[model samples]
Target: MRVAVVSESFLPTVNGVTTSVARVLEHLQRRGHEALVIAPAAGSPSEYAGAAVHEVPAVLYRRFPVGIPTPLVHRTLADFAPDVVHAASPFLLGAHAIGEASRLGIPSVAVFQTDVAGYARRNRLSAAEGFAWRVVNLVHDKADLTLAPSSAAMSDLAAAGVQRLARWGRGVDLDGYHPRTRFEPEVAQLRRSWAPNDELIVGYVGRLAPEKQVEAFSALRGVPGIRIVIVGGGPSESSVRRALAGMPVTFTGPLHGRELARAYAAFDVFAHTGTEETFGQTIQEAQASGTPVIAPRSGGPIDLIEHGVSGLLTDPDDPRSLARAVTALTGDAGRRARLGEAGRRSVLGRTWESFGDQLLSHYESVGARGPVLTRALRKVDVD
Candidate 1:
């Protein structure tokens, strides 16, 4: 089936939205399905996995591109005439696209990946919380189906009065980020470089944004025998660096693909500092790498962790909970190994292929009532 994926962010951004969209594009390409990408113009590639990428006007907001409203969305949809529209982390641009799709009598699937209301709370924009949720509700309300990545997200959307909601989680790269990577020569060398005196590595991977609460890692300042590794860059880099000052920490800016996998494999414990995550993608990557995880008992992490079974869940309200969880695992190699192994086992069959197929099923079910049944899966009309 032909699908048009409208994402709030895309390549060169490397956040959860971009990562998931890229994986979906790759999946569609592999399954012989035609696809098109509509994203913000932030130096993204012209094409991905054989699908042509159409960029729209965007403005920099907090150092990230935020797609602005444009007539291009309506024109593009009218031209391509996809069977279904997949709105990835629907926000301003996404809401507009969904509205356009509805006007064109096309079905849409809105994926609720970002928590804008939660972000408002984190940024102390309490007044904007209601407004944010209103926008979220309005955007998702138009879709034929709204896919939420976690129970927390589903609950939030439901509370906002969004209907036609379904729980859809993100997939991990099983082979790329596996337990075997720990034994790789490159990973070993990298670990040695980060922890010269053989310190336990407590790592955090993801953007250093304000809503991410990355500064929470500051509580680990005096922690013993653990080197903190911060991967990924964002607007909050300077402040986060200041917060982690005088600690045994190393910032790797950002690492992708094999390097990102190696970073996860080298960690003794993966510490996710973010509290507003709609879906903890880094936590999954850490689990896939056989690294014990410590995430706050909030948002998406709640669904990903089993609290002392597969991994540890800390108190999101307590600033010291993260540091304490890391301390508990720092001296216990056996426990960490057990937790890591369990985490790896938990995600064994949760691959992109399986998730992609699940997505196709959703498309088929939704498209069955629309133009997809009669129209052939063909190339999009660029003109």
Candidate 2:
């Protein structure tokens, strides 16, 4: 089947949306399916995974490109005549594409990967939250089906009155992020450099943005026998540095491929500070790396982790929760090993192949909707 993917972020951006789109394109290519990627212009490649990428005019906002709505989107979709449109993290660009797909009578699937409303609330932009949800509902409401990455995201969209919702979680690279990487020479070197005194490494991998609550790492300032390693860079880097000043913290900026896997493998415990995550992809990476995770008992983490079994969950409302979780793991090596192994076991069969098949099934369901099929796509367990 031919698919047109309209994404808010792609390539040079390298966020969750871009990563998801890349995986989908790769899967489509492997399965001999044709695909077209429409994204904001920022010196991205002309093609990826055998799919042609169509660049659009965009303006920079907070160091990121925001695609300007254009008539080109409609013209492009009309020309492609795709069987389905996949709207990744629908916002400005995605909204326009979804709207155009509706105009062309093409079935479109809008994937809800970001929590715009949650970001508004996290940043105290209460007035903007209502407006944000309004935009979310307007964009998602137009699509034939909206795919949510987690139960938390689904609940949020349902509460906002968005219809035709389904659950669709992201898949991780089990091979890249595995338990054996810890024994690699580079991983050992990284662990030594980050934790010179052999202190337990408590790592966090993600954008150091306001919504991520990166400053929460400051709570571990007085904790003993642990070093903090933050991966990924963002607008909040300076403030995050200031917040964790004088602590045993090392900022590795941003890492990818083998370097990222090494970081996760070298970690004794993975603690994600963000409370507004839609799917918490990094947590899955850590779990796949055989590293125990500590995340807020909110959003995607609630679904990804099983407290006291696979990993630990802390209260999102409590500022001391993360630090306490880290401290608990620091002193118990046997429990950490048990939890890490369990974490690895939990995500064993959740490969991109299975997820890609699920996505294809969704596209087929979209094609089989209405008169062809009496009911819409049935929601299924994400396991």
Candidate 3:
């Protein structure tokens, strides 16, 4: 099957969207499907790795320096003639791709990855928040099927008027982010730089941006023997660092593979304060690595955690509350071990392979919308 993936974000970007898409693309290739990734040009063609990338041109704003804009649709998509267009987000590029798919009688699937409505308020686009929500709903409404990473996210889309919404939950690479994965010597250097002693290492791994509420990392400062290690770099790095000026925290640029796994393994507790995270992928990785997570109660964690059972979820935006939860979890080794076991158990069956199979089932259902892409291509050859 030929699937065209249209997304506003892709490789070279270290965010949840990029990570999730990369996993899906891997499984798609393993299943013998050809997937074309269409995103804003980040670098040379070789930068795309395995998948074929169509780089459109766009300027990125300073604050959100990592985001690439695709203001127009590329004509190459029509030439390739995808069987199904899986559009990620309803941004300009994604909207253009989905529109073309509908005009060409192609089946389309839309993945709702973020809450752009909430983003508007944080980004000072309050008046446009409703507009963003409506545009996203319109895009998904036209899709043969729309995917949300969590049941809560699916409900959010459904309530916002996306009719064909369904859950296509995220999957973690158990091997990639496992307990045994070792740390880089630099990470040990990092641990020493931050802790300098036998301090309980608490961590947060994600974008260090305003929307992510990174100030929550600063809340654990002076909490006796707690050291914060924020993995992954972002536009908000400098600001987050300034906010934590002189605190016992270390910023390890960005880590992958063994270094990342070690970072998770070293964490006595994982913390995320974002209220709008649709599904926290990092949370799953942390939990899968036998680390107890402390997240806000508002969005993603609602699906990934069971509060007191597996982990704790406090009031979103309440850093003091998050700090208390972190303190409690890190203070009790028995509770941390208990939550760690339960957390791993909770995510045991939710693997990427299972997610791919689930997605393929949904694709077969949506791909059946027309005579199917294969049959259409065969007719062209016979002609």
For model 2, residues 222-247, the per-residue Cα lDDT tens digits are 99999999999999999999999999
lDDT of 1 by residue, 1-383 (tens): 77889999999888899999999999999999888999999988999999999999999999889999799988787777788899999898999999987876678999998888987887688889989998888888999999999999999999999999888898999999999999999999998999999999989999988888889989998889999999989999999999988999999999998999999999999999878889898899899999999999999999999999999999988999988899999899999999999999988888999999999888876663344532432223232
Better of 2 and 3 by lDDT: 2
Cand. 1 Cα-lDDT:
0.89
For model 3, the run of ten residues with the poorest summed lDDT = 63-72
lDDT of 1 at 309: 90
lDDT score for candidate 3 against the true structure: 0.77
TM-score of decoy 1: 0.96
Off by over 4 Å in 2: 368-383
lDDT per residue as tens, model 3, 236-354: 88889998898888788788877778788878788887888989989999988988888889777899999998889898746689778877876689999899888888898889999
Clashing pairs in 2: none
Deviation of model 1 at 225, angstroms: 0.9
Candidate 2 Cα deviation (angstroms), residue 10: 0.4
- Per-candidate local distance difference test: 0.89, 0.90, 0.77
Best by lDDT: 2
